[model samples]
Target: MELIYMKKFLDACHQAKRITELMPKLPERMTPRHIHVIDALFQLEQKEDSVKVSDVSGFLGVTRPSITKLLNELESLGAVEKIPDEADRRVTLIRLTEKGKKYYNFYVEEYQGWLLKQLGEADTEEFMTTVNTIARVYKIVSDQKTAPVFPGEE
Candidate 1:
């Protein structure tokens, strides 16, 4: 049973690594980090009038400095605009520019097509069953509030 679990865990890790490697191949004007930022921006775009750097940093689980750097790069590329909040002078809000929206749409479409091609080659039923099982396991793990024990952890 333990060996079976270990084999499944390693296989899942390998699949995750492969997916990570494939993400950078998408057509986008930014790095993976920047693309991730754009994704977040898109999520917030409709929910709120604008998003803040701190909001993105917290949502993405990234540091303020890293978010700032990404924002600066995005700004330079004319992909996003930083608008000062009217209520607070200290707060700077972020919004996608037209160019950013166009690029994001292109990136999403290309990525979906790529993934569909990859998954289409697999046995659909088996692949979906595996995905559903993994989703259930992920939900179970995520529902636990405490930190999980790792090997050699005290």
Candidate 2:
């Protein structure tokens, strides 16, 4: 039973990966990873006054090094600006640049449109119910596991 469940989960993850791979071809300047970091920045927009590199790392459940790499990429792309904290010069605060905001909004709209088009052909009620069910199951399983139970595992 566990094996069967694992197989299905793997299949689902493969399908999701395929979709993510296609996102880069959707007339966007940023890669999917860049978009993910931008989305995290958007979520932290309300706390603009206190947004820090560590804060973003914690919020995104990623390591500081990983966030640093993403930040470096974003900085190179002129999508984010890193400023030294006034009180503590060692700490860096990150904020989205105007270009970042523009691209983020564009990607958000494009992604939304793509999702809407994909789901429009399905029965809305059933599709939403399935999505909710899957989300709940995923949350429960993810919270109970120490490691990811899906892809990237051998």
The clash numbers for all candidates, in the given order, read 0, 0
Query: 46-71, model 1: which lDDT tens digit per residue?
Result: 78877999988988877999999999
lDDT of 2 by residue, 79-133 (tens): 9999998999998889999988876877776775778797767897887886786
TM-score on alpha carbons, each prediction: 0.65, 0.73
Pick the TM-score winner.
2
Candidate lDDT (C-alpha), each: 0.80, 0.80
- Residues forming the 10-long window of minimal summed lDDT in candidate 2: 22-31
Assess candidate 2 and give its TM-score to the true structure: 0.73
